[model samples]
Target: MSDKEQKSAYGLGRAARLNLSLEMLNEMANTGRPMDAVLSSYFRHLQDALERRDRRDLENRVRSVLLHYRRLLWWLKKIKLEPTMRAMLLADMILSENADIPQLEKLCNGARNRMDMLRKEEIAALKRLLGKEINHPDMSDAVQSECPDWAQAGLKKAFGETFTEELAALATKSTSDYRVNTLHTTPEEAQQSLASQGFKTEPCPMSPIGLRQSDAGGPILSETDAFRQGWIEVQDEGSQLVALFAGAKKGMQVVDFCAGAGGKTLAIAAQMQNSGHLVACDVHSKRLSRAKVRLKRAGIVNTQRVLLENTYDKWVKKSRGKFDRVLIDAPCSGTGTWRRNPDSKWSKDETDLSELVALQADIIKSANRLVKSGGRMIYATCSLLPEENEEQIENFLKENDKFTLVKAKTVWEENFETPYPCANEDYLRLSPHTNGCDGFFACVLEKK
Candidate 1:
């Protein structure tokens, strides 16, 4: 078993878990792993540590600590703590789940330096001190929003100065929502089944196949028969919509060019009614293996999973100009996914984004070849930055003489029973404030 697996197998209390998380974060930050991926790794293990009945409580508390990390760091610094002291203070605060000031001071009373110093403060005044610090002009806007300095300018250029507030709100509450598996159950049936099993859910307004989930204090829906029987699969509504935009049809050839774990590929399978050839192709065979389980659970039989040697795979070259639809879920900075993985904002920068842009360009250039004449290819990323979204599509159109833009808004308006949520006419621009989902950009291009 992997080291991560071994860690999951061992038991740890809340404080110990927080310490492990901090150590892992420090190492991962050094190695340049995105906070979202790091947190996913950390939290999944924490889930394994708790009993099923107690899992939700531990999960909720840890999420709160992680979600407020920026504020916590700023708060620690404001109170005259050094860098080393800050990590210790943060761990104590996390163990207490950022409790009331008096309670927090009690938790820290045994600690040395700044934390011990804080225990001497008047109990009633600590919150006021916190407000004074976080409310200062230096701490407001992007700093207060927990977004990095370098990223704020681009975001302002995209959504104006007010985008900070929306971005900040998204940093909290990474709830578990699922997409209704239409191959097995209707949205209403799926919602009803979960409700019967003590889950609070409603049909997602934007995507017909989505279920916005709420907790009912029983086991998470993951442990329910409804899930095991393939009534639902955890998927963001933005993701469900991206699959919809691909427009797969029964008996048509489709390629999910970067089908990591087959999230979109399964959605596409339902669209195809399991009657056509659906290739779930990715560079990682491990992810494809995992995708196979989801495909089976989702009752998706028309799809075949393949490992790509690279963009220039022999299979891709041979299948050139054959697929009716090709979906490029390109790798990206994942700026749009900060709602669930707020730590990611700190890990990404222009240099990393530039590398991703080049890779995206390369993948699209090679993957587009699989689209037959007049077939649609959708270029997509879970990134709010234009450099990775609309700009990439614009540059691709310029470079590829035979491909033309397919206005996403028009397609959304005509194709769906409800109106599209975002205002961008030529490409998808889903965000937390507007769509109540993670940030995503998708644009369709058709080969001539």
Candidate 2:
């Protein structure tokens, strides 16, 4: 092909990016890679291979494709066609209005038969799939809700049927929200700094230091001076609440067990005014390494980073009954984070749930031992399912009579300046529909 034709055929647009992201989704499904890791790895490789800056719109378009993955698969099932044609016609259907059909020719490196099938499969199947409604009701509960059947049942049983509609929006459509690190600057100062740089931002209603910006049109958030200078960190409001309810005080010894990436650990440190000892422990060394960067960026110093060699580490054993408070951010199905990780909706299953629940039980029991008598421990997860949230805490209280439940409502009334979308009266539960944040569950337990 001529040089001009080559550029025209191979240029990656919205549809092409969606096709590429579908590859990421496939890897996440097949390889069990976290959606965040898979997407970041693919985009990084794409940018390196093409020797071009990433188009901001590309990630958004790809996310939209993944968000509608259930509907896309439903159509593929209906078409009676091979599932192997995902990158060509299947991705285009989701991006139909803006799909670049001609680009598929070069995406395939000038393969003729595949292109013909993509167009000619136009036979009867395309017609059937084309007219499907925006919220197609032809699907069962699982597909319509874009979740696993067990998750759908659990959420519905706990929250009600109307809650299922909110499940439809697996991810937030607005620009990401951030929490201002008061340890560095005030919320207004952080807002002003970002606004001065042409980033449109608004205060999050619930969090005193929460700032939100629309990704529709804005520079990359991580690139902002506010982030680099430790004025802000990308955190959800629900998360801020979880940390707030942890009730860390100055001069107190605290342990943030299972502190992945240190989002809440930083919050706890800031709340403690960097006064006392705070140990951030996690089993994953890589995640703690990432947390080390965030800690430095946030100008945090009070916290000690501990890499737990295992669930029962020597460090944990020495630290047991030493801390005034402990926070267990246990692993779960991650259904609550669907607003940020839409692909997770498709990846998790019952087997994963069984394993995670068992892990959570073990970690919570082990972590609770670190809390001193009369001290508090926040048992938390991003799972919407009660099995991982209330049930775990309930069982813990049942098994260990020395520890008692602390009402989330009572604590919220004491600390929060704004009202929360309260899901459970006892535990702090936030959902996407009611709270406009990622789904989260938190219950504070006190050691007697």
Candidate 3:
């Protein structure tokens, strides 16, 4: 082939390949496919193409493809178009190579800037979608400021930015952390176990059993016997605090309401020294089944799992005011987890948030009835929105006059020595950037 003809053919092929990637990314994003799934599929295709010798500069080509598509996704998210429509538009735009790249970049920047102005109504809607409130102040503010004109206008009209400005300063990243299940082993033992399997570990500054990964890209979970034996269950340090705040001791009766997969439930069981009754309840049987397997692996014998299917009322009545402590790890928007699930920010909308808020309110009220008089009912979420966290607590206090916010500082100081940027007041709020943990908020409410 002539040199000129070969060069022209290569250029055309490159353009076609780039267009294909953009189409796939748009489809996955709009269809609400999990980001992990999308990335996995993209990587697999890249590997196959490389094996077939269909592409040169394989790594660079893959990187460029991802960067181009990510930019496109960011633009689509900004325009406030429905996912299906957004995907269609993205497909069309990619086909038109004459697309204005500069214009798209501008729109992405504008959306980011307006996220902090997220309206009150928009905030409420977000709460309903996640079945919880937003807790990270900074994240909430960013949403308000960077939300597109459509969302911002709607939010302003419905709920003027009555959000706490203090929270905006408190938003941070979520950390990749795991707590050592002290029920079966100590931190030192867990560390030794992990190290033996070639997994490097470092102590988390904010949490006692928490450890951070020093290296990336290894089968840490599959290779370690400690994980297999349940000496350590992968959990956020912030989540560990939920059990710590419960103050579960030997012989105490504790109920882990909404104990999906028994992460915190197992933590509480360990805290009770396996000497007390800990009932872990969830509406979903599949999650409870998984929890059972985990419990077996941990050798935890003092805990039992209950399925409350189609009978939340009956279940509540059956065990009313029967536990020394009750934990309501309520459903939430998960705004604080944006670092890990950045796509959630785009997938979420006002309608979803509204539904979540109502659910959270109902769950809290129902769970509160299970706590014995003077017993604590701790509420927690991984979200950073105030509507899900602080506001929900505020509303709960107004409706139920018997519960009072416990001083979080007291419990935090007694258990750990790390100083948080946000004061330990009525609630314990941790951010990833500031506290080096997952964005989490916990409020210990004592029945007065």
List residue ranges in candidate 2 displaced over 4 A. 1-19, 48-54, 85-119, 122-124, 171-175
Candidate 3's residue-wise lDDT over 233-252, tens digit each? 88877778766767778998
What does the lDDT come to for candidate 3?
0.63
TM-score of each: 0.85, 0.89, 0.69
2 versus 3: better TM-score goes to: 2
Q: Model 1 misses residue 81 by how many Å? A: 1.8
lDDT of candidate 1 over 1-448, digit per residue (tens): 3555445533534444434444555655577776546656655655555566344443444455555566656655665444442343453353344345655555345322213335333343345343242334656676567677656766777788558666765775654668878888899888888888788887777898889876557666778878999888889988899999898888999999999999999899998888989999999989999999999888889999989989789898899899999999999888788777665666667788789999998999899999999899999999888888888888988888999998888778756888877776888888888878888888889889
Worst 10 residues of 1 by lDDT: 110-119
Per-residue lDDT of candidate 2, residues 1-448 (tens digit): 2334324322644444444545555666678787678767655555433322343444555566667666666766766755543532354453344424344434444232123234556434445544345355587766766676657777877677676676765545633788888888899999999988877788987888788885345566777898789888888887887888888999999999999899999999999998899999999999999999999878888989999888988887887789998989888888888877786776778788889999999998788889899998888888889889888888888889998887888878777867645856788887777778887888888889
lDDT of each: 0.74, 0.74, 0.63
Top TM-score hit:
2
> RMSD to the native, candidate 2?
3.7
